[model samples]
Target: MSDLKKQATSMHKAAAGLRAVGHRTAKPLQEFKAQSHDLSALGALGSLLSATSEIREGMTTLTKLTRQLEEEWEAEAKLIGEVSDAFDLLDVLIAAKAQAEKG
Candidate 1:
C-alpha cells in the first residue's frame, strides 16, 4: 500500500506485459527467419534474408532480456510489499507501546 510498493507493482505489470509481447513475437520471428532462408536462393534476395535473420536474432535477444527483466521486477515488487508490511507493523507496535505507557 506504500508508494514504493505501488510503483513496484506497476513496473512488474509493465514488465510482464512486455514479456508476453516478446513471447508472442518469438514464434513468428522464427517462422519468418526460416522462410527467409528459403528465399536466399534468389541471389540478390539473399541479402534481404540475411538482414531478416539478423533482425530475428535481435528479437530473440530482446525477448530473453524482457523475460529476465520481468523476473527482476516481480522480485522487486515482492520485496517492496514485504518492506511496506514491516513498516506498518512497526507503526502499530509503536502506537500500542505508547498507549500501554499512558495507561
Candidate 2:
C-alpha cells in the first residue's frame, strides 16, 4: 500500500512487459530473417539482413536488461516491505511507551 511498494511493483510489471515484448517479437523476427533469404535477388537484400541482425541483437540486449530490472525490482520491493514492517513495529513501540508513561 505504501508509495515505495507501489513504485517497485510498477517497475516489476514494466520489466515483465518489456521481457514479454522481447520474447514475442523474437520468433517473428527470426522467421522474417529466414524468409528474407528468398529475396536475395533484391539489390537491398544485404542491407535488409544487416538491419535484421542489428534488431535481433538489440532485442537480445533489451531482454537481458529487462531480466536484470525484474531482479532489482523484486529486491527493492522486499526491502520496502521490510521497511514498512519496521515502521509498523516502531509505531507499536511508541504506543507502548506512551502507555507505560501514562500508567
Candidate 3:
C-alpha cells in the first residue's frame, strides 16, 4: 500500500512538471501561428504586384506594336506615290513611240 502511494505522488509531480513545460511552449507556438498569418498576407500582396507588373509589360508591348504599325503605314504611303509616278511616265513613253512610228 505504501508503494502505490509513492507511485501516485511521483505521477502527480511529473504531471506538474509537464504542465510547466507546456505553458512555456504555448507562447512560441502561438507566435508561429501569427507569423504564418503574416507570411500568407505577404504572399497575397506579392501576387497582386506580379499581376500589376505583367499588365505594365503588356502595355509597353502594345505601344511598341503601335509604333511599328505607324512606321509601316508611312512606308506604304510612299510606295503608292512612287507607283503613281511610274504610271505617268509610262503614258509619256507610249505617246512618244507612237509619234516616232507615224513620222
Candidate 4:
C-alpha cells in the first residue's frame, strides 16, 4: 500500500476513536442531567440546580460541536482515502510503463 493510504487509514481510525469517545461521554452527561433533574425537586438546592442546568446546557452545546467536528473529520478521511487510491493507481500505471519501456 502507498504511504498516503497508510495515512488515510490512520486518520480514519482516529476519527472513529473520537466518535466512540463522544458517544461514551454522552451517556455520562445524560446521567448527570437525569440526576440533576431529580435533585431539582428539592427546593433547598436551587443554586446547585441552577449551576447544573448551566453545565448541562454547556455540555449540550459542546456535544453538538464535537459531533460536527467528527463529521468533518470523517469527510476529510474519505477524501484522503480517495486521494490515496488515486495515488496507488498512478503508481501502478507508472510501474507498468516502466516495465514496458524495459521490454
Q: Which structure among the candidates has the greatest TM-score?
A: 4
What is the per-residue lDDT of model 1 for residues 8-50, given as tens digits with 9 covering 90 to 100? 5665565456446646766865675465446444466647556
Per-residue alpha-carbon lDDT of model 3 for 1-103, expressed as tens digits? 2343444445445545544554565566556544533444445665766654554455556555655655565565455445545555665676778889999
Q: Quick one: best lDDT, which candidate?
A: 4
Report how far residue 81 has shifted in candidate 1, in Å. Answer: 0.6
Q: Which pairs clash inside model 4?
A: none
- Which residue pairs in candidate 2 have backbone atoms (N, alpha carbon, C) closer than 3 angstroms, thus clashing? none
Better of 3 and 4 by lDDT: 4
Over 4 Å off in model 2, which ranges?
1-49
Assess each prediction's global lDDT (C-alpha) against the native: 0.61, 0.60, 0.54, 0.63
- Tens digits of per-residue lDDT for model 2 on 14-95? 5455445545666765665555445444447656667655555666666566557656665665565556566556666767
User: Candidate 4: where are CA atoms >4 Å away?
Assistant: 1-49
Better of 1 and 3 by TM-score: 1
Candidate 3 at 39: error in angstroms? Answer: 26
Model 3 lDDT, residue 59, Cα: 51
Q: For candidate 1, which ten residues in a row score worst on lDDT?
A: 33-42
Residue 84 local lDDT, model 4: 55
